[model samples]
Target: MEEWTIEINRSATKKEKPNTDQLEFGRVFTDHMFIMDYSVPLGWHDARIIPYQPFSIDPSAMTFHYGQSVFEGLKAYYTPEGNIQLFRPEKNMQRLNRSNDRLCIPPIDEAFVLQAIKQLVYLDKDWIPTAEGTSLYIRPFIISTEPFIGVAPSHQYRLIVILSPVGAYYKEGINPVKIAVENQYVRTVKGGTGEAKTGGNYAASLKAQELCSQKGFTQVLWLDGVEKKYIEEVGSMNVFFKINGKVYTPALNGSILEGVTRNSVIQLLQHWNVPVIEERISMEVLYQAYLDGSLEEAFGTGTAAVISPIGQLSWEDKDLYINDGKTGKISRDLYNTLTRIQYGKEKDPFGWIDIVNEANAVKQ
Candidate 1:
């Protein structure tokens, strides 16, 4: 067994902190960031926390050409007691490794990397926003650095983690918004990289998102790639539909990205005995349910937005208004419960909170 130690390089000067009230999603960054490099024999080495500045990379980096990259998004919150905490961060690391497997990137020591994240966040703890509906967004990403033009995986990689103060992922916040069902551009298929948290997956979604945004939609609800009828996910989150008092979300069938918030929502619903089912749900079935007045609520769940209520879903030019274009009871309750637990306002019955201690942050 080898010990994975991280080096610390404090920034000489601190950056100006953004106003809590004016914070937007991923716009303002912290003063420091974490970086680690990987090569053939050295593996992942030279883990360090340095100033948040850009470093030069080869123009032919494989990440830019072949797209061998993976990333994960999580958050750090300020509890009411003034303690810094994270919600289910271990799950994010686990998912990152899973994505690494899909993208042929080398595995990382999840526990060690998690410690690095804690240290980095703790070092910049003052940047965390205490205002309502605000937290520190964490992005952990790995990019292939080997400047190769071939279509194969690179031998060298770089893992970096940066922190951002974010207010809300959607302008609508927790309020309900309109979504358009994408019938033209499919997101991914069962055997594709759809399940991986890679740049390519998100890159593929931009086209559909652009089209939907032009039509005054907040996001596009994607269908499966093959037949293009089964519901896949929202552009940035996993979607759920409540029909006849039962909550149904698209099953994880190698095509949908397994969302941490989606899983949490499912567990919370089950804990409340709300009859949550994960199965293949087609848009036709959902539309039929809406026509029959059984579709009670619809929402998208992810780390970015936490929970986004879908008040209107447009499919084939037919508009379906859910809960009378208002946030439903379940959506409201879930958002409140999740956010409360995150901010330490409510009890964490699931043991999902991980506290960050400044003393245990860095080890030489």
Candidate 2:
């Protein structure tokens, strides 16, 4: 195994940290960031921590035209005991490599990069918010930096990690939200890049999202591209529906992004002896269930909101109000349990918490 060492470069002038209570999602960033470079023969090299300032990339960079990139989102929480910890960060690292495979980017050393993330978070520990529903959002992304216009994959890449103190992902917090079902625009197909956590997948969603947002919807509920019948995703999160007494979410169908929070919610449901199923769930079936009063609740799960209750889902001028347009029991419970575990208020039986040792902080 090759030894990977990250060189440290502290920022001379630190930026003002935002007020925790007034924090919004991804608006305010911390002082330092982690970066690494990769090329054909060198693999990944020049790992370092430096000031959070933008560096110039060539105007004709491949990433600008070819859109070859991948990214991951996770967070660090401030425990009541004055310690900082991450919630299942290894899963994010593994997912990043999976995205890399889809994008034809070089694989990164997951363990080493995870260490660098912890060190970077710990180095800026003061930026970790203590307010409820607040956390230090961590973003790890890779961009094709080779300044070439050809269609082939780039020979060079840059991986960078930046931190932001964020509040609730949705303005509603843990409350239920209204979503618009999209039938015209497709997110991705089974054999396409939908499963990859790349910028193109999100870029594909912007049009529908914008249209839905104009109609007073919080997010857009996407249907599968091939048929436009089965449920795929809800904006950026994986969706679930509770009918009768069992919970069902769309299975990993290669076109749907596998979400870390979605997996955790499934595990938690299983742990609680709740029946949760992963299968093809169609909007017609869901609407019929709602008509028969069997569709009890609906929610979307992701690292951002953890769990966003679906108050109402509108499709073809019909509004399916879930749980009377209020937060459902299951949704509230999952949010509370997951968040408690994240903030270190509840016992972590799943061994998901990774503690960041403050003692490892590099001196300025």
lDDT of 1 at 195: 84
TM-score of 2: 0.98
For candidate 1, give the lDDT of residue 28.
86
Native RMSD of candidate 2 (Å): 1.2
Maximum-lDDT candidate: 2
lDDT of 2 by residue, 40-75 (tens): 898899999999998999998999999999999999
Per-model TM-score on C-alpha atoms: 0.98, 0.98
Scanning candidate 1 in windows of ten residues, the lowest lDDT window is 166-175
Question: lDDT of each structure?
Answer: 0.92, 0.93
